[model samples]
Target: MTARVGVVTFPGTLDDRDTQRAVRTAGLEAVPLWHRDKDLKQVDAVILPGGFSYGDYLRAGAISRFSPVMETVIAQAKAGMPVLGICNGFQVLTETHLLPGAMLRNNHLHFICRDQKLRVENAETAWTRSYEQGQEINIPLKNIDGRYVADERVLDELEAEGRVVFRYEELNPNGSLRDIAGISNAEGNVVGLMPHPEHAVEPLIGTGRTDGLGFFTSILKRLVSA
Candidate 1:
């Protein structure tokens, strides 16, 4: 059967369509999931795309974390379903406690939008299997509160367990602690990142680079093999 990947759209989400397009580009079915809906439509995977969900009020993803759809997503994610959260979506993952750490305002207190270079620190995660370890790729990053922070112990644990999946290369855009751009759960089924991979999936858009396509392709490969 063709793998189906669901893209969740919350009240203020803006990248659900782009995420669906990326799924299709990766030869998978794109399933639309509404924040108010509890059903997942049996999608093989789920993506919480970037955007100012709930207007990013009271912290970026705090409100969206309580959405009905997320109720089921949280359950499924813990049960080993593959979950990928991008940008604002990453904030939601952190809010929901599906991923470690928290996102704070950009250290410079500025909204940054740029193509960021990242190194694949842990390619064994469910969302990064397509990239080789240590490989470098450029993807667009845009957000006001994108800095990732955690206690020293948690940061050390993430690194020690090889859960820090992606790290900023050369230049850290948002001043995220340890230059962490992305991370995965211990089970490797849940991954979150601050960059907008969906925006970089196509070669004709957003810096004209296709480096982000690997993220979509990586999930498809995982679902297909399962």
Candidate 2:
């Protein structure tokens, strides 16, 4: 059976359609999941796409943490479901304590939009398996609050555990600590990143590079093999 991946749409979400297109391009079924709905529709994996959830009011993702859908997502994620959070979705993941660290405003205090270079520091996670360790990829990144911050000890622990999945290469746009662009949970089932991989999945879009297709393909491979 073809794997089904859920792309969630919160009230202020803006990338659900692009994410769904990416999933379909990777040969998976893209299931639209509503923030107000409790059911997951039996999706094999879940993706929280980039967007200003709840208009990023009260801080990005602070309010979306309490959404009803998150209850099921949190439970399923804890039970080993693969969950990928992008941009604003990453903010929500941190707020829900599914991932450590907080996203602060850009160091320059301005929204940035560009094709970003990132090194695949750890490719063993469910969402990054298609990449080779240390490989570099270019994906589009756009956001105002994109700086990732964490306590020193927590950062050390993540580094020690090989959970820093992606690191900014060459250019650190938001002054994220240690150039950290993304990280995965200890179990490797949950991943949250600032770049919008879905935007780079098609050759005709963005930089005309499909480097981000690996993320979608990675999850599809895992689901198929399981």
| Model 1, TM vs. native | 0.99
* Local accuracy of candidate 2 as per-residue lDDT tens digits, 155-177: 99999999999999999999999
Error of 2 at 33 (Å): 0.4
Clashing residue pairs in candidate 2 (N, C-alpha, C atoms within 3 angstroms) = none
lDDT of 1 at 99: 96
TM-score of predicted structure 2: 0.99
**TM-scores, in order shown?**
0.99, 0.99
For candidate 1, lDDT tens digit of each residue in 145-219?
989999999999999999999999988888899999999999999999999889888888997999999998999
The number of the candidate with the highest lDDT is 2
Q: Which stretches of candidate 2 lie over 4 Å from their true place?
A: none
